[model samples]
Target: MTYTRSEFPDTFLFGLSASDPGDEALTEGFDSFRFPVHWQQVLPRGRGEPDSGGLDHYKHLIDTVLRRGLRPCAILDSSTLPDAIADLGGWRNRDSANWFAHFAETVIEHIGDRLFSAGPAARSWTVGKSDHLGTDLRAHARSLHHHLLATGHAIRAMRSYGMTNLGVEFQLDEPEANTALHAYFHGEYTKDYLAKFSPNLPKNWQRDFDSIDEPIDWCALNYAHFKDLDGSLPWSSLHREDTGETPLYVVADLGSVENTENLLGDIRSDLAQGAPIKGLFAQAQEGECLGLLQTALSGGKQPAPWVAPTKALHGHWNMVADVGGTNTRLGVVTNGHLDELHKFPTGSLEDFQAALRRVRDAVGTDPQAVVAAGAGPLRDGVIQLTNASLTLSRDTLASSTGAQRTFVINDFTAAAWSVADIKAKDVAVLQGSGSPPPGTRLVVGPGTGLGVGALLYSEGHYHTVSGEGGHMGLSPRHRDEVDVFDAARRIAPECFFADSLAIEAEMFLSGTGLPILYQAVCMAGGQSDTPTLSAKDILQAAQSGADEFAVKTARMFTEHLGAITGDLAVALIPVGGVFLLGGVADKNRWLFGQEFLDAFNAGGRFDDIRGGLNLYVSEMDEFGIVGANNFCKNALAR
Candidate 1:
């Protein structure tokens, strides 16, 4: 059967084995590439400073792979150690493990962030049986123990830099006729070998092994022959039971079409039987093998949709728009700053297109790029507004504005991106002090509707994770809250009551939900004479301390907002801080006083973690516009 990319899991990586630099074309149809970075070649002495020229070459190779949109997986080869280290006993020496770890650290310091994955050595452990290492069993065992130790040490070193995707390659040879040798190589190597040789290992060896959390993220298996593939499945299951890792099969030495077909057929069968394979790596010296693999994977499908350009367009204007439920804001970014800001009411999609045309006419020239962030879920480069009848897509934006590149993202995703460029003067701290730890940042806003998104910092870039977090179910915390929620359910059963008696966080926390909350409060408090009020009137009366129900509603709103934010913060652990956005939070800053703090810090056993998190209210009026500009500058410039 012909296999397509869609047949495999989306996260399953297909890749090629690259041999040299400037082999970008070899990676055209692959998601990743495996290349060797020799230890002796990089560090001639294997102990002191590295060769500057060697480091530069590898750096360029990694950059080229990334430019081709392929993950670069480095193989730190130690099969041929430097002559200086070879004379000093090589893998037989305990100190060699530490030296290899230092070498790994040096490489990571140069390009760790860009690396998608790495392995300690490339099929080096299997070379122990060769006569070059002599015919002594004890000596071979010592070398094997040190190799595993070096692998563990290398993994530990990478973990220190927050680079965790790591693995080890093993060559699976055919089962020997001699059962003793067969059992020793296939089964004992991973199971009983470590425990049996523990007493003979170097001092403090267990420490290094314990440092590894999951042993390896993946185990790469290279079979000696096509028929040997059947042994891999059971072997993988056994290994996973022992080490908690799945296997990535490596298809090598494909000399004929028959061999390639047989290999792929076996892989497909294995996958159908639920073999728990992680991915596939096809070893290729020419384009023939990769070409066939790509053809089968494509299954006559068309190419993917147009993606936004990664590289920035220098000396060109970029247009950005914040398409909201009530208003639409458009602006042009020139020389890395937002300018020519324009605002108008949002109507139909056609109206939005007309507004884009007007903006283009006023600018006197078409922008090189356009990005619009609307309040909704973004799917296939299109956003359907949650609280508005309008829909925005990259196609419409490009057609209307005559732009070369276009993007559509969720509104809160733009807010999350804006956190990367937010200034101190534009925000007021609600909780915690000093700068937050560098990691993920959460952005929550209450406007026409509640919106939530998170920004994760990794590989020198900020990635946005947007979703309908605002729709999460909210439960009553106390007797007073129970009465209010019951009243809310009776007032708006469709909005508050679902399969359960839980209400969505946005039902009582957003602009549209504010008046609902006010009426529910009035009804629950037996205020039969209370007049109907808009969200504005309720906030005004609460601020003036004139209406008892209005004041109670405002307090309940802020307190619930604080409680929900704290719960999300605890779940996400966004060490980069939680930023509160939108006009509601900015204008009603006084409401986020003592009661808000008390509700937010009510995490019982997790009080310390919740209370220590940095919380702020953003006062920037043009946050979405600034965020779109930041997206153009940062994300596209990558």
Candidate 2:
């Protein structure tokens, strides 16, 4: 697994935002690994000893990585760990030598033997310390020197354990990289001007200026990378680009460097021109980071000083995997942020792979890091190897008239595949994140049809059973007009409730349901002559409390929606919140807000049945995207 000079043309060294060596490399097939060890974990709270947390577990994890052929680097994180926060009274201050040295000694004494390098993933001061009051600018950046020395010393000490490399990861980790607040960092020109106005400026400003002390000596960060996780953050962030008119993403452009792919080439050029080290470290979001890095590495292009991790997975700190209906899409969410997207549409085998190719090419991505593209639902029924079986399937279809044309998938199983974890916080739904019972969660979206998913919590994990539970027959509330029953009968004439007897809750409660209710109202109220409008139009009028018949329809739709949600809740009682998603949930907030809650919570004697359950709206249309990214990141992590 050793990276040869030619393997990385510029001796690129890739690693993680977090993770120790063996755990890092072995997981994602990286030659090297990096895991940040919180200093708080290394040093105890209130000036005590650090918690070992059974170093053997870590040792074993690393050993696992090493056995899998990967190099691992350990990072000593002093700032963000909870212990550090707790010790600092909810603030990351105390950049003291004793703390640094003590933590360094701890690492050297612990698993130093297995480490490829001891890293200090440097922090770019937090907003609190800079804006408020803590340390002056001089003291802020100077704080790094103490920690840097400690890091260097630890590397020296850990090397005694048969170690070979030591590295520094100087980060401008501020997602607000390009904010105007950073204008002070430019130099004395702004410094004098600012001092003249404020006299005693905020400690936060001073703290921020601390890191700007010296150009991070290139010689020290011999193997470094600039992590710009989001490009649109800069290009379209704050509308600061040359085009001042375009809407801006809150995460401004200066905070990140995603606008230019050549940004990497520039960093390499700087390193070669005696700028610094020879690697580039960029952020690939939670799941896509290492995958994209690997993609870059595996490509025919000559690699730079950027070092790739031997292993990669969605960091446990914040990871989510969302499987799509029909197994066609997957999304990865990290700490609730949807970051990566992978999708495979159910199509002709050949056409599917071709579409996948189109998707990859459109993203300007390479296919080397792709493990496999799978098909089928989680219930274990249908699976078509759309990627692998494409050519043969196409030929078969062309030659044999009996050949199946389109791939059929069990959308429920696909939904379950994404929700297969032992536990989770929020299940994707129409009403964002809802709080349910202490087990798995269930959401039933009844659109044109029903969409059923069960969130199962087991052995400290959350699993969702996405199934076609929508087609179930609806109960006739009050001898529905035989007319409606007759129409339903025409659509589905079989089974106990079909053909005039069965009414699906979906047609009565989902995105397509409201209109039916409205249509029924119009016909019953003698306004059947009114122009036909889509479900969306009815809700729009309902939202404004207009269109009398629309109001009645909205109320009825809300009632049915609540009834179905109640049924699902009673069945799952999900401890994690129930999230309502899709077109109906997003737009019909008025209905859910007013009458739906009233209906669901209005149990004559069983109010307690629905009392504890929480409801939410899934705002991001990219739930599937996040699910896809989560799947990729988690699969890679595993």
Candidate 3:
């Protein structure tokens, strides 16, 4: 059967390796091109400043690819080290890693935005033919080890420059011959290098390797020749599954028309047998081979860019739910206005599906779309509540509510989305002057658990990014705080999940954390006979000034909250505003006074930036619901 490109998955990328940008016809039928950028050519000396002429040449080539509506995959050639660096022992030179990292950073800063994918260097650095290095096994091992190290450094540098979609290239050989060699190669690149050759590796090399987290996002396999198809296909599939790396298969060295057809046939057979191939590429060094591969790939079209799925609301009747740890708030949006709001204890329901069913019954109308924000980590369209024994999923929400589409987002993400609709009356300002400018906004609060999310504005639309900022390690500032923190570490060891005496922000900032903080305060004051008080009791006592321990606990909690919020604000630079939400903040607005403001604006060098930030305590109890409604409207409009 003659196979067509239509048979492959829509997201599967098909492209070729090209050096000449002037040859526009070379990329006519391809969606991507693998452009090899030689380090020796760009940096010549492999140190100091990069050559402007060489940099512009590659930049122009990348620009041409983008101009022609094709994605460019750049591969930095590590094999061709600059003459100066090679003289100093090339990859074997320990300092060469830093030089390569610098080069990677420079290249990424210049053209990272335009490229679809990038690699620190060609894959041959790790798995190339080892015969060229002679009989010195230690030298050969060190060279290979340093290459991997340099690649790791380069990957980190590229990521720092905001380059995502990074990858690595590997050459695939015969299955039997590859199995053992590939294992050794993979082990060295991953976590097992030090175990195998600790003596040969550089001092403290394990620490450096440990710092790298799953360096590459994808792997490009160079498929040249495989005699045993049955043996090779399964091995390749197993390798991809084991490494958890997306595989992009490239048929290397296309010679004749017959050879190209045979390779294509092999690819078709692999696809038919369920090979996990995410992309396909053809390597044609010569003009004739390029023409042959192009003709063979005729009728193939570039896949459209992937966009997150959203359901358009047919009318104004949309359902929104804020699934908090203690209570669940459900509301209906009519013509962009929220109405028919209902509240119920979250613990009373079995799961989110039952809650959705109750809302549907109360409203007597099926929602066009449903957006449920939960207080937990969202994974695979589901959330397992951190404080409550409840689970929510998009499928369950859709089935129960009879909505065309459903969204499961973090509770803080919902709060961040609400920032666009916040009014002057609903906000109580604590810092800065007038209204905040249009940029990034941060919404963080302490409730059952500390929630953190950011709203980023780009292309005239707001995008929400959620994070587990509450788990960040908290440090004491003064002597009193240090004493309380140390006491808490001894009294409540369960709250410290990390190293000894390491207290997480949520361990003292959330509603659940308040009771622990109060107990710690009593212990620090050498009063161990005090009764264990609930978070509510402590808050009431503190508000009435009846208990000094409770007041101290409240004060410590707000101070830590300010410090953590300030740290996050500095890191995120939420220029729009820093919003404080959740029940604890709403109920205890008086606690967030001068001390909280002082703590927030306490950055040593960044004091001016922190002081200039607009801080607001959101009094709106339906902030999450309103945010959900806004999110639903925006999604539907999109």
- Score each candidate by Cα lDDT: 0.72, 0.45, 0.72
Give a tens-digit lDDT track for model 2, residues 222-328.
Answer: 11223445321222222233213321111111223233234444444433444323343333234444444556555443422223333221221111222232344
Is candidate 1 or 2 superior in TM-score? 1
Ranking by TM-score: 1, 3, 2
Poorly placed runs, candidate 1 (over 4 Å)? 1-314, 434-437, 497-499
Give the lDDT of residue 353 in candidate 1: 96
C-alpha lDDT of residue 497 in model 3: 60
Better of 2 and 3 by lDDT: 3
For candidate 3, what is the TM-score? 0.50
In angstroms, how far off is 112's CA in candidate 2? 21
Give the poorly placed runs of model 3, Cα more than 4 Å off: 1-316, 347-352, 361-365
The residue-by-residue lDDT of candidate 3 on 16-62, one tens digit each, is: 77666576444576777777887877888888788998899998887
Clash count, one per candidate: 0, 98, 0
Show where candidate 2 strays beyond 4 Å.
1-351, 359-439, 446-449, 478-496, 526-531, 544-546, 602-605, 631-638
Compared with the true structure, the alpha-carbon lDDT of candidate 3 equals: 0.72
Clashing pairs in model 1?
A: none
